[model samples]
Target: MLGDDRGQSNLDFLFGISVFLLTFLYAVTFIPGMFTPYQPGAIDLSAVAYRTSAMLAEDPGWCNSTAAGGLPGNSSWEDHQDCLLRIGLAGDRGHPNILSLNKIKALESLVASDYTLVREKMGLNGSIIYDINVAVEMNGTSLINAPWPSASSQNIESIERVVLIDTGKELFVDCNNPGEQYNSNMLNVTLNNLTSRDRDITIRIYNLTAAYPIGLAQDPIRVVSLSGNAISLPPDDYIIKLNGEVKNSTDFGFMKGDVLEITILNTAISDPIISAVNIWANSSCMPGRPVDYVYDPVFKQKSVCYPGIMRVEVWSYAFS
Candidate 1:
């Protein structure tokens, strides 16, 4: 009876051991799969919102016109003229070409509207002068290829004459004569040999409005030299007025048939800044009207006027 009991106990022990090994093996294989996390397929609310909003915010006009290359004729002219005028006015002021198209157009419209009223009310003869000129170029060339009177007419006459006097280049200052000695806080400038004999000569300082004197009061300033020659200056960084007025300076004056040398000097607080000096006739007996001018990057300069018309040029210098 004791032997039978021992045999039964051994069988039970073996059975228990088999069951424990099988359970351990099963857990080792299945435990890792159970604990591993699955990636969620749920959509991200924020990502969807951002992408949709970005698409909606894009400019409709720009998108519509992007594939349609080149500006329309009128739009091109308007853009060009606006840019030119800003550049012309950027005299003793800040940089002009840095402005965007929208800003420039707004400014041009305002100036044109205001000046139109002023000219009519004042009965100004000849033409109402504006401070700037806008220029345009198409297809990397200045000569407008469009037929006369077409939307892109190269001829200046076909376009609406917003400003009565139409010159490819806009004349800001219309003084009869200019003098020599001019002074400013930073430097002294002088013009010489200007007289009635000079015959409607004009000295244009580009980027004038960008520099110091912002308006007519600060500009259209006169300088008188010892020789009694008189010169009118639109405000420019290169030209300075003594006592803040040209009339008080002795070295200022214009002489008939003489070369005018413009000098710029530096001050303690500022380095000397000078622009290209351009001298030309205010008007000419040229039969052709001034074509709406454009910049020629290939030429590395602005447009050239037709034969018998005034030409524009640029000069630059570095201060010591």
Candidate 2:
């Protein structure tokens, strides 16, 4: 009896060992497959569904409008009319990268292809609103109009244009232009031009609250400086100095009703030559209603249903 009991105990121990060994081997093999970099919903021969349900769950508003059919069927005149204005203003302009209404529509279409609406809210003001956020790569492209050739004799171009934090403060003007000139002796021309016009070439930053002043010096909130083509300003939080004095962020913040004026003055010549000015801001801040409501026009009026204010922040850099 004692021998039989001992034999039974030994058999039970072996069985336990075998079960553990099988489980260990199975785990070692299965874990690697589970952790494979390929997504489970990826197009594999074994995958029954090629489309991922999670992709469908994302918000459709996040899609790229240009990639999708022009406009969604549900869009209203107010929603789609602004696009018409953008296209009109940008039509065949040398700069192809400006954000036009067509581009906005394309963005919407791209969003629809990958995502579906989960929830949306209608504001009291009769605006259809969304709280959707989408993750996208920063392609390092400017959404605003690209700076054109300097209308002035001196060539200055604005680079790294981006909208900073939204403050309700109004802006008068924000403009950036890059310019260049060719001469028989490139090195001599560059050196002589720099020496002569270095002090006269002033970049004037302004925050205009009323109509954009037709002349440069007529603006109210303005900061002027004379420097080389590239100028780097020191970093100070919440305060931006225009001349030598510190001022409020609202004085320079990019906001609704605010404008940025970039004036490049070529002092080398008898009369200082001023370059062209570029304008940008939420269209809602414009003083008057959209001029024309046709399928295409230069300016489109947008309702400030979401963000009620415009904010501007300026940073200066020197290019090589």
Candidate 3:
């Protein structure tokens, strides 16, 4: 009877050991799949790409407040990296996603000099780094392609932002008619009552070949006014008189004679920031390069504005 009891006890002990081994094997099989964390880096990478795209498309950007020898805002931001606090392309001061050509150029210059600076400015840090690519597309073709040096085999995470480009268009006015004459050399351009929608209007006065008269050759000048009044400029420069007071520009030189070309340019106009372009001219229309004015091939006779789509692209390979 004692031997039988011992045998029964041994059998029970073996059964218990077998059950424990089976359970242990089952748990070990699933340890890698169930106990280990999934790839969390993917979520982080996707978030970073979206955040960068938003910053470029939405932020109006900021300049260094302390004046570290850098030009502040607009076209002046080009070439002065120390001055830029943020990088944005939007134009409408209040609107996001609208691109500004001036700001685009500024950022292009900045990134070209050092792409790492962009990542730092974007608040990216730690072991993860990124490769960024910015591009502008129109009609399925790339207009502007800016990218950092990156390997093609590296996994890339990319995002795109749609944007509108601010461009210039050519405008022609016939001052030969006596009624259109503001003076013998100047023509009257009615402001079209563009209250809030006013653009940066540029007026260039020259001859048939687009030559500025001898004494009137000078860079384009900005003039603004609300009521008709005489804003005197130097002799030998173009004359453009607007209703609003000039906000930011120097007075150009103009000469008194038969006017050839009277071009008016206005940018997206808003209160407290009215901008206009005025050039001086006379009958001679001699060709000369003004510090401010340069010939653009887009226009055959004079300067004009053209609209384009700005395509901004970003790429990251750290976790992608």
Listed per model in order, the count of residue pairs whose N, CA or C atoms clash below 3 Å is: 50, 42, 40
What is the C-alpha lDDT profile of model 2 across 1-320, one tens digit per residue?
A: 45544345788999999999999999999998775648542222112111111121111222223423666432222234322211111112333222233333333443354222221211101122112222211234222232211223222222221212111111221222112221111011111223233222222233333354222111222212233332222222112334434443323444323333222223322223212112223222322211121121322222111111111111111101
- Stretches of candidate 3 above 4 Å error? 1-44, 66-80, 138-147, 151-154, 168-201, 204-315
Model 1 has an lDDT value of 0.27
Question: Which prediction has more favorable lDDT, 1 or 3?
Answer: 3
Report the C-alpha lDDT of model 3 over 1-320, residue by residue, as the tens digit. 45544345788999999999999999889775664337444335556677877877777666654444456454223334676666666654676766665567666666777778776776664456665667655446555445556546355556766666654332444322232323332233334333434334444342233224233334433344555343433323332432223323333333333333333322322443332333434433322321122232222234332344553344555544
Q: Give Cα-based local distance difference scores for all models.
A: 0.27, 0.26, 0.48
Q: What local lDDT does model 2 show for residue 198?
A: 28
Alpha-carbon TM-score of each model against the true structure:
0.16, 0.20, 0.45
Once fitted onto the true fold, the runs of candidate 2 whose alpha carbons sit more than 4 angstroms away are 1-21, 24-133, 137-320
Question: Judged by lDDT, which candidate is best?
Answer: 3
Q: How far is candidate 2 from the true structure (C-alpha RMSD, Å)?
A: 21.4
